[model samples]
Target: MVTKVVVVVVVVVVVVVVEVVVVVVVLVVVVVAVVVVTAAAAGELVKVEVVVVVVVVVVVVVVVVVVVVVVVVVVVVVVVEI
Candidate 1:
């Protein structure tokens, strides 16, 4: 019967729409997961860079202080000998 065919067609269309919606939802979830992971990795890299910079600065400061101390001691010794 024509009515039976129409009813079957409607059911098929409904199923297709439901399937499409589920696929879209899954895609969204995958995209969100990837973004979160990338952000976390980037944040960690920034933290490491900050730590390395701090260490370099501290080392330079310490070296400069040691050099200044050595120079002062040498100057004092020369002045005393004269």
Candidate 2:
């Protein structure tokens, strides 16, 4: 019974992570497309600014995702240990 519970938990975590990854990828693609279109019409300075902003946003998102995954792993480990 404990093994079954752990398997379910692991499966759920995997599904959630996959969904998050898909969403992030879609968001990044959309943002990049928008930035490209805007940059084409805007000046060089604006393009540089947009690029910087995109980089910062992506970095922040990656950090958040990493933290979430770490927390989830810790929780799972604790649960299994119990």
Candidate 3:
């Protein structure tokens, strides 16, 4: 019974992770397109700013995903022990 529950949790986590990754990838592509268009209309300064923002956003998203995964793992371990 416990094993089945753990397996379901693991499967759900995997699905969530995959969805997050897909969303991130799509967001990056869209952001890149917007940046390119804006830079072309604006200038080098704006391009640099946009690139910096994109980097920061990506980094933050990665950190959040890592933290969530860690928390889920800890919860799963606790549940299993119980």
Maximum-TM-score candidate: 3
Q: Evaluate all candidate structures by whole-model CA lDDT and list the values in order.
A: 0.59, 0.73, 0.73
Q: What's model 1's lDDT at 43?
A: 57
lDDT of 3 at 10: 83
Give candidate 1 regions above 4 Å deviation.
Answer: 43-82
Residue 21 displacement in candidate 3 (angstroms): 2.4
Instruction: Tell me the TM-score of each prediction against the true structure.
Output: 0.49, 0.50, 0.52
For model 2 the local lDDT of residue 52 reads 70
Clashing pairs in 3: none
lDDT of 3 by residue, 26-47 (tens): 5788677877787787654455
Query: Which residue pairs of candidate 2 clash?
Result: none
Q: List the residue pairs that clash in candidate 1.
A: none
What's the lDDT for candidate 1?
0.59
